[model samples]
Target chain A: MAKENKEVLLQVQGLKQHFPIKGSRNVIRAVDGVSFDLYKGETLGLVGESGCGKSTTVRAIDQLYRPTAGNVLFEGVDLATLKQKPLIAARKNMQMVFQDPYGSLNPRMTVSQILSEPLQIYSQRKIINMTKEEISRRVDELMEIVGLSRFFKNRYPHEFSGGQKQRIGIGRALALNPKLLLLDEPVSALDVSIQAQVLNLLDDLQKEFDLTYLFIAHDLAVVEHISDRVAVMYLGIIAELSPANDLYVEPLHPYTQALLSAVPIPDPKIERTRERIVLEGDVPSPDTERHGCYFYDRCPKRMEKCKGSIPELKAVKGDHQVACFLYE
Target chain B: MENKTILEVKDLKTYFRTDAGIVKAVDGVSFRLDKGETLGLVGESGSGKSVTNMSIMKLIPMPPGKIVGGEVLLDGVDILKLNEKEMSRIRGNRISMIFQDPMTALNPYLRISTQLIETIRLHQGLDKAEARKKAIEMLKLVGIPAAERRIDAYPHQFSGGMRQRVMIAIALSCNPEILIADEPTTALDVTIQAQILDLIKDLSEKLETAVIMITHDLGVVAGMCDNVCVMYAGRIVERAPVDDLFESPKHPYTNGLIQSIPRLDEKGSGRLFSIDGQPPNVIDLPECCPFHPRCEKAMDVCTRKYPPVVSLEGKREVACWLYEENK
Candidate 1:
């Protein structure tokens, strides 16, 4: 699974995002010192349970919720310190697709308007000077590229189905032709039938455009299907990062083993017979200052050492990094 | 069949009168549940799994949604023909349903204690103190820790997985005979999903109640269900033992569903092959096989006419022309 070029497109270093609780005087470490690299033209799947800071980390990368402290180097540019204008300028080359397509798109805007506005802003051409005919032509091309028909160009967001609305969202994101896409559970909202269609479409689009993707999702099967390398996030920290094939086949970390064991296999016989590692208790409160591994309380294989020091993510095998005292 | 049948639904059709058309959400669907067995109803969204469950409980709204037809027979009694007085007694006491979204299914304003106890008080005819005691016990039953403290907390205070457990506790308050969970873990993460599913399995063993689990996740069905029912566009496409369904799926739709679920074994074999198209629009569906449009192996007869249930010797039934006697 090793890449020939192996060029890093985006590198996140010690990214920390701590939000102050409304009444309490303590901070909720949503994304506490998370770091990972996104290689060019490759998809890195980020997975975790809800409140494990998977969404918070993606929000930080998309600059929607800026990090409290830490560096986000997109092509060696520090986004943490970038001014408003530069942030806007940088956004032209970066785009996001959210979990809920219904809530993300403006209900009133036509598909052409939604697609054209981004182009109109980035191109800097006089708005009125560009005729309606020209703007629609470009929108149609974008639709066709996304495998959506041009018949949907004039339709409102409400008129289209959930899958079609998602296509519109993809079309809008593609309007800018961004270098990196922070897709946050983009296919989670759709049904399995449509989800597969959209996922396959994404795979084709990635190869066609040579786009880099930061896919944040809770689905292992889908993420493992789509991702090149996947980072398993738990309580705002990555427990394991490895090639998707390796992670599934030979997972090292106890948490990864538990996580993989917990996933029900599609084969009924195997699913019935396989022994599952059930993690104990809910994910510990990130608002509290946690000791040891964030998963120590729930780790089925937790040891006495796991309660003392937080294990660093270190290489256990070729391109496979695991953060656990057992591995250490 | 006397001892085997737990719940039987016959010719149940639930419809919604929308502005566009009358959506036949659950069109002439019939199935039976065995005692202490989990029947997994698998389908895409709008395939009427949820609607069928809701219709059985008579929870469908009057103006837009109506039961329209069929009888929901639980333990030889026709519950569908029963009046409101009878249904209310059966609703939470004999049969309970767990919705997909725990956040919305639970009241944002009320504490878990209040929600759980109110149902117990109404159904079980318990006093305030007695209901409170039962609620705490029910909470503990679902594996929620420190139930005495967590019981009084509102839905917002709990996590997604925990809130779902609360919903389960409420559903199991009266120790119902049947539990209909529609996409119970769809909103939660996979890790938590496994936990909840295991909890359900353990609880089912303890309670010995029939469970109708409706979901799109074939992986979950494979693990959790005793029998799996594949639904497509308001019709049950295939119904068989879980092992038989996965090992030798006769129906094209059933085969497609298993293929669509990405597995570790599928890696380095071939790319993920999706079912070609979406489920048919429920309203005004065509008179042929509902799966004809997306079906890779569609035949002339598949589009011209619908396939009847090709019943096998031991309890397997598939609705595909490929299994027809004439074919």
Candidate 2:
């Protein structure tokens, strides 16, 4: 396939990762044949259900789980085929900010040691063995950057609240100063008031550092908030991909339509007026095989051909790609 | 226009006695629920939304958590007056709860039927066969197909959304007049969360049951609730009709929350209006308004003295000094 402007920072092509089921010979298609392009300085929100390969795709991109097939070209280098040393070296340019602040960090490590470990692994010797004054200054700078106070440096994860702890997580991620940050539901675990603070902090940091984000979340409202472009994934495929505004207001795929309808609009009047598209049935197990569309069972506008042949992602409008039989 | 109080919580304060110091989780929180109406308890985590709900049901333990003050009245009957045996009998029979994580709520080893039957027999006083019959009905009511066959399946056999349905079915098994749902769809995907919310709304309407939905998502409350109570630092900061709360939120904390939430409609808006400070420690909550530390419209009185509830006509009450400006 031919590409447009070369501003693309990461190009994921036909990424497939299948985790073998415990006893059964069948493989759970955690992420299968997924493809998307993330541009420089753009926040691409990946929205989906719990089991849907959103997390797996991000993990695969981070090289935590190597893809069984396909390619992840990071800055024109194929990361899927890289070995141990090169992969770890490539990791310097890519950092992952996990979801649970409490579970993500080692509880035993103080905030100072936690931040310094990354610096020791990636930074120079002179920078590593700097005086206590210098180390505290650097940690304080990072802490202040994430809106955390200087006093929180010596505190453990148990001492700080969920929101304050997440700030420390963000500070550690920024320590690497990577070009790309893979945020996996970064603010989902925090409280509503704290979520906004962290989100605003992320926005400010992104602008200041010119960082590109692969923002993964389950909530469309938060996704719509930060994403320049959005991708709707179901069972392990990109069902809809378009700019955030175009995708939310004028969704082409039935799944996208239902997802938009399902979100409870914060306005009571609008909510009362809006007809909800309550989808029937549960998400099929990833191990289950489908002949055509992944969303066919619950899709409101499911067509006969939707079962006959798997629909390919075709452009419904300019820059709007949808994989549904309705377009055909 | 009508006063039909289903649940009346009076000066309800549930404190967790920890070694570091006592955590005054639900500090002097008071509210009323009307029959067939939805009241939303909105707050960030640790604001005690869940703690308040748990205390009303007497789920909080003694060593760590205790309801130190106030009475919880349900249909003119003070639930707090009941002893352990009485409280146990009334719980799950009069009022039920559905949690955020369905997996944790349902037993993985037991069949869905076994779980549902236990709830039915314990509360409804049904025989084994009769409980089984009701379990089938509930499964069907929650839109689980082949309900009879699926009822015999384990929790692992069902999907995340279906397990949530089972949780709801168990919660509604006793047909309680009041249902307390604490972030019922928080971790689920967007589509599944939507369906669960839709189910709650449809079922609540059909049963004409009062619902106290505890959630951080303003979107969920806007759609499912008739009225909302915004809490911060263990205090109800604002209470109003859902629409009015959204259109004109008077409390600075409420104001901050509404602005901070990334809206589905507000596509190209700038960065969300984040509240500048953290929620104060519940143990060391401000003597004045709890939200005064982070409030943009904080006044001198806001720091030294607590603000009184200012009434706006039509059941809206805001606890903020800026509402005095409106007056």
Candidate 3:
């Protein structure tokens, strides 16, 4: 839960990312008018399916992809309008951990080299000529933070296992001591046994470093486990946002309810007894513009009011916001 | 023969001759499936769940992959001893399989009607028109709307969920006695996964077809399987009824796997219960219990040798040193 007195570290206002086709007028509306806030020391989980724009939203916020429209405010300053030097300085406080541990880290470089590269890049801005001793000490500290031993620092990324490779990725992300971590499905690629280990390590690191995280994943169980607040995305828009437990227990949006019900429980007795709400049809293509709700085509409880107009996200309960008109 | 067992695997051992060494993919795995029953083969990436099913199918390539020792009895007949001609006849007609990715399993260039009808023609020996008619019926049976019009479309034209439905339609067209669905719904979204699971369950019941569902997800096993076999490092560590396994798992590995996954119905302690180490390397596994290094309750004996299967009441069985004394 976010404390009332905590400062808003990052605020995303109406973030839209649209990619235009080269030969056609069609645009892939990846992220459309998404908004959210992150407290100084909290994990905000962004949950959605593959094409739901959670990845695009995170990239836009990280400035990996500039937004087609709207603004990403990091401590009340728009990242889109910042100068090159200022943006580089601002990015020093924010870091992103990618999904594929194998592809995200450089395969050619040793763990020591990978960890030192970030420090070397940021050293010129800090204006301190880093001595070899200081860089080596920092690398050892980073490896220790991510539960890797100093003995294996010289090994390349290929020599390490999937879990160990993920540890290196996390270590490199923390090399510069960033305040906010944009973790995009960090544990999804790992095996179940190793996933839990990496997840625990991440939880511990967040507290130890006083870091805020924008955690993105598709697994509802994982998101509910780690997130203080959970946002459900559908067709490039946030369908609902609520406290993690509350969202799980009593979801406001139809899409959220369907997603929750679809997660098969591990207990056979409970799984057999529970009624599942299987939505009809596939997710519509994002290239086509829908006049109303993105979920209107599949929603069973859809009505006349659901067509020809979009519904803005409004608070339905305490700290629970839904974009559906059912609450109204 | 007296029992209702539809498929029985006895001492299945599959190995691969790699550059490093002989990798024991499925080391002495055994299980049984009755008529109309679903047996879930649950395991991690290298745990050999897929290899076990492939060995049964006689699909392992001979040069590198070999089924060195095993008897896959489909209705009291050894499938492994059968020649290539005999195996091919039985493969699609009696025991069929649906792969993980429908896009790859389906040919991109061919029409949906072509792929589905070819299987029907091959298995049932029906003529072109009859096979095409049966294919459309199968498509409608799996819940693809406008089957007549969409039958001419290519695999890319259909959505992921619909392509999977087409795959399921092709798998179930011949109404095989056994269906091997290896992660059938893993590629689809959750809502679509639910629909596909329901369709499989409903269709299997109607046709009285036994299913061998291979997947890593415990949740899918809980909903779909009557019996569950938890595989770790090429061995069945635990086997029991789904309810029994969920309520009281005996093996330390099974317990760890259950605890490691976050449950949607319950709020966790914030600190996740994680298993300590990676799965043992199959190429050069230790002689002792392979999971002893990571098992929290590992005794001295656990590190010395692999434990024998300890049978308990209610058809429950576990291979662990903790239960060796009880046995």
Best by lDDT: 3
Worst 10 residues of 3 chain A by lDDT: A123-132
Off by over 4 Å in 2: A1-6, A123-140, B323-327
Better of 2 and 3 by lDDT: 3
**Candidate number of the best DockQ:** 3
Candidate 1 docking classification: medium
Residue A276 error, candidate 3, Å: 0.7
Candidate 1 — which residues are off by over 4 angstroms? A125-135, B126-131, B268-270
Q: Taking the tens digit of each residue's C-alpha lDDT, what string does model 3 give over A177-230? A: 899999999988888889999999999999999999999998889999999999
Model 2: how far residue A306 lies from native, Å? 2.2
lDDT of 1 by residue, A135-242 (tens): 667898999987877987888888888887888888899887788888999998898767877888888788888898999888888889999999999888999999
| DockQ, each predicted model | 0.63, 0.75, 0.85
lDDT of 2 by residue, B163-225 (tens): 999999998988988899999988687778888888898999887778999998888888889
* lDDT at B168, model 1: 94
lDDT of 1 by residue, B8-103 (tens): 999899989999898989888989998898999998888888888988899899879988888888889998889999899999899998988999
TM-score of each: 0.94, 0.94, 0.98
